[model samples]
Target: MDYIQPFNRILLVGCNECVTVCSAGGRKEVGLLSSALQSAFLSAGKSIDIKEHTLERQCDPEYVEELVGMMDGVDAVVSMACGCGVQEVARRYKNKPVFPAVNTKFMGASERQGVWAERCQGCGNCLLGITGGICPIARCSKQLMNGPCGGSTNGKCEISKEVDCAWQLIWDRLKMLGQEERYLDIIPAKDWRTAGGGGPRKIVREDLAG
Candidate 1:
């Protein structure tokens, strides 16, 4: 991500809303990134100035507008928000370059207190009705739409013992819900063309637009 721009006065901006809820891009993360960048620059004897700021919500235009005046002295900004927030910042400040500090993982729920696992692939077509509500695309290592490969043993995936096979979870869930017959149906291969295309994607809802 750093290869996108050459920054001198870098502003590490974080968000206090969704990013904070996901425990990724928050005030603490901003401070940590600022300190780390400062240390790296100092060690290389490079005179780069870095600052930190946390917005209530980076995606909101009102909150992002406040950054316009503050960006006067900065050369570039490293936003710690999701891809949506990064694009929002870039859209607001078209003259300046904005880089993403954190990798946008996915839209999913947290498995444990601090462990968030991805459950959706945003394939544009959802097949949870037949898969017992478990997403094989995100959970399975191979993203197999069908049952677990011969690699699953003792409920763990062949790729790693620590990871649970998605099919295993689906089977268990179906049995618990008394809907094991759902797995009998076969699902076809997902079309990658509808997902991410060769370039950027866009969605326009004429009715939703004012």
Candidate 2:
């Protein structure tokens, strides 16, 4: 709200991808935000024109190009998708201002109804095979690869009692699979370059491009 000043006419673009499944930036959320913003402007003695639309996937250029015609009446756009979606929209329409309405939290899973938990960090490495399917990079508070940190207590992490000790779960899973010997293996330090540490990353396949 504080960042949206100087723009009375705006468009709210929602994504029908991950955000839609998570109920964050779907068609339903777009409608709610549009109504709320309109009400807010009216209450402040100002009128706002809000247009709402949900793309199949905002991260794709084909979907983002749909907004070109809709941009005729709106001064700015409020994207309800994740950061990637917002960037794609901005890239498609360079002259218009774009803003994000939802904070992109993390790559997580729906633990239960109305509840989600982080699952993957996209760390550019897959240690799940050795770790017995538990990702220490995402679940461990310290992202420990070898074993549990000193802060792990009673099969729980020091960050919170609710948070399980990732290493403990890994060990248990390995034991169940009769592969506890793998636990003795020392994993080397991660090369963060593959994990997007070397600035923005890209993949180009000449065979697929043409």
Candidate number of the best lDDT: 2
Alpha-carbon TM-score of each model against the true structure: 0.83, 0.96
Poorest stretch of ten by lDDT in candidate 1: 1-10
Cα displacement (angstroms), candidate 1, residue 89, comes to 2.0
Please give the CA lDDT of all the candidate structures.
0.85, 0.92
lDDT of 1 by residue, 68-181 (tens): 777999988899999888999999999888899989978888888998878887777777877888889889999998799999999999999989999999999999999888
lDDT of 2 by residue, 1-210 (tens): 766778888999999999999999999999999899888888988887888999999998988988889998989999999999999999988888999999999999999989999999987878898899999999998988899989989999999999999999999999999998999999999888877898888879999887
Which candidate ranks first by TM-score, i.e. highest?
2
Distance (Å) between predicted and true CA of 89, model 2? 0.5
Pairs that collide in candidate 1 are: none
Candidate 1 local lDDT, residue 50: 81
True-structure Cα RMSD, model 1: 2.8
The lDDT, on a scale of 0 to 1, for candidate 2 is 0.92
Per-model tally of clashing residue pairs:
0, 0
